[model samples]
Target: MGLAKVSSFLLVILFLINGGSSTTFTIVNQCNYTVWPGLLSGAGTAPLPTTGFQLSSSESRLISIPAAWSGRIWGRTLCNQNETTGRFTCVTGDCASSQIECSGAGAIPPATLAEFTLNGAENLDFYDVSLVDGYNLPMTIVPNGGANGVGKCNTAGCAADLNGVCPEQLKVTVEAAGTTGVACKSACEAFGTPEFCCSGAFGTPDTCKPSEYAVFFKNACPTAYSYAYDDGTSTFTCSGADYVITFCPSVSSI
Candidate 1:
């Protein structure tokens, strides 16, 4: 066979062997305490090998995400599994299923979310660290190991402890003693008003401009999504790059 034909044959074999395309995500836990990482695949998407797992402090794990997959990931803290029932529960980022797998359930509001839509048109990946639900853990997403195409591929997330400064009304307090202010809830989740939730008449970008609560989040994590419609500046794009999602990349008070 000619040289060009030989190269094409090799490419075909590689593709078949690998079952097409995918990306690697290195999930890291840098907090002082352990965190349970939870994964939830988007509607009509195939799930990963494990939906939830334990990550001791400063631990890391690699996850393979298939091409065109969309999903959301978050960290759950202070979790315990019932020995008798085998049901699991967490103080933060709890899904209704009450099991480790999450099994098609998404995280409840007030939990920091790392959202991703991979291998979209032009082979680009779209991702963001979103606080629209609220804030529980500090997280960051960095593109690595590829020619990440243009347009703000810079790392994005909340690295600060928004909980420390969270307004009283938005603070999520656990009934168990010594677990107060563990998470900071969004105004939308706390108030459930049309203006805060961006629903009803306040559904449009023009209508739902940033309120004082959103401003607080935006000030702390400038690159992260502060509210439901914080799209233009918060969304990030990259092409053919592996990602590192680090929870609590740096220690912060409160």
Candidate 2:
């Protein structure tokens, strides 16, 4: 056989061994209203094909993610474009890009985030639905077609709508027709104290213990990362899997 033919054969073998060297993510909008999904690639990782887009209720989009990609995905709600200025903005999870695409910008907290680090240590994909940033909407991450890693490849997220039950002080309200809560703010974002933010003297896990606010989130969403150091039950790992991210996921579905 020719040298080129041999090289091609080896490449095919590697592709099969590495599970095609890419992952597919299906982003679904299960909410009763519209949602704009924003994506931000992690530092040193290439951006995906899209940074942001709108998804009407029951709609879904598929994105191909390169191997070793790391990023966070979240949903933006109550978006509008000003006709006079042509500026786009959202009430929650806005990336502040003035356009549909985030263009390398991240969601301005308090936004729930679905975080991922694909093909990481030991070739495992680490993922979690983090409320540590705060909570704008119910979200979940479900892994498909992956070998079980040290951590279980189970569904992870907060499926409950926290806005209605959010503390008055941490509630993000909008006055469309009347005052209505749209999102819940984390204690760190609401107060900005070292004890809550996990900064300064409380930077370490040992020093920074869960507060009453953190406990509130944890009690509502046991599988999510409620605070900065809520890792024990928050993180999950898988090997070579496509992911399905759903916004406003039903509690029973999760």
Candidate 3:
């Protein structure tokens, strides 16, 4: 082969050996009701194959994620379509896209989020299920088939249903069937205060401390992020792992 062609071949081999392979995300919906899952790639990251889609109970879908991709996934509940205007919307975790696909829009607050930073520093994939935005439904991230990395590849999520026990001040209710709590709001989302939001005077971790509301979530799901600075126990790391993200995972399995 020509020298240029040989060099090109060598580069291709190097790319495949060093983070060129894609990762698979298997999204499962175990809720009794339907769920509309939304995905948003981080700024400057490549877009995913599909931004949003519907998943009936017991249904699942597989998505291929390029190496080094970073993004979040969340499920929308109580979604409906407006026949007159052909608009789509959800009671919780709506992306405001007016369609099933979120396009590039992120979830509205009060949504449970499974955030991922794949192939990051030290080639570890950092992941966490966050209620820092608030809680909508039970969700978990289970890493599979990863080589031992910096941190344990343990499951991370808020598998407990927080809506029913949510504080009245943080409850989001819908009156469709009757008055029902569908989601719980973070103190920041509920009150917009500097302390709850960890902003302004409370921007630093030293100044911002978990409040009563955050403590409620922490007590319920010790491994999930309960507030802006609840990082010590919330984050998990793995390398070259395919993820299984399940919404409304069974308590016994969690």
Return the top candidate by TM-score. 2
Residue runs of model 1 more than 4 Å from their true location after superposition: 2-19, 177-179, 251-254
lDDT winner, 1 or 2: 2
lDDT of 1 by residue, 96-162 (tens): 6778778778887779999999876666789999999999989999988656345457788889987
What's the TM-score of each model vs. the native?
0.91, 0.95, 0.95
Q: Alpha carbon lDDT of residue 92, candidate 3?
A: 96
lDDT of 3 by residue, 1-254 (tens): 99999999999999998878999999999999999999999998989999999999999999999889999999999999999999999999999999999999999989999999998898889999999999999999999998864568899998899898999999998777465789999999999999999999999999999999999999999889999999999999998789999999987656
- Number of backbone-clashing residue pairs for each candidate, in the order shown: 1, 0, 0
What's the true lDDT of residue 154 in model 2? 89
94-184: candidate 2 lDDT, tens digit per residue:
9999999999999999999999999899888999999998999999999988875455788999999999899988999988825678989
Between which residue pairs do clashes occur in model 1? 110-133
Alpha-carbon local distance difference test for all models: 0.87, 0.93, 0.94
TM-score of 2: 0.95
**Candidate number with the higher TM-score (1 or 3):** 3
Count steric clashes of candidate 3.
0
- Model 2 alpha-carbon drift over 4 Å, by segment: 1-4, 14-20, 148-150
Top lDDT: which candidate number?
A: 3
Q: Which whole-number lDDT from 0 to 100 does residue 39 have in model 1?
A: 94
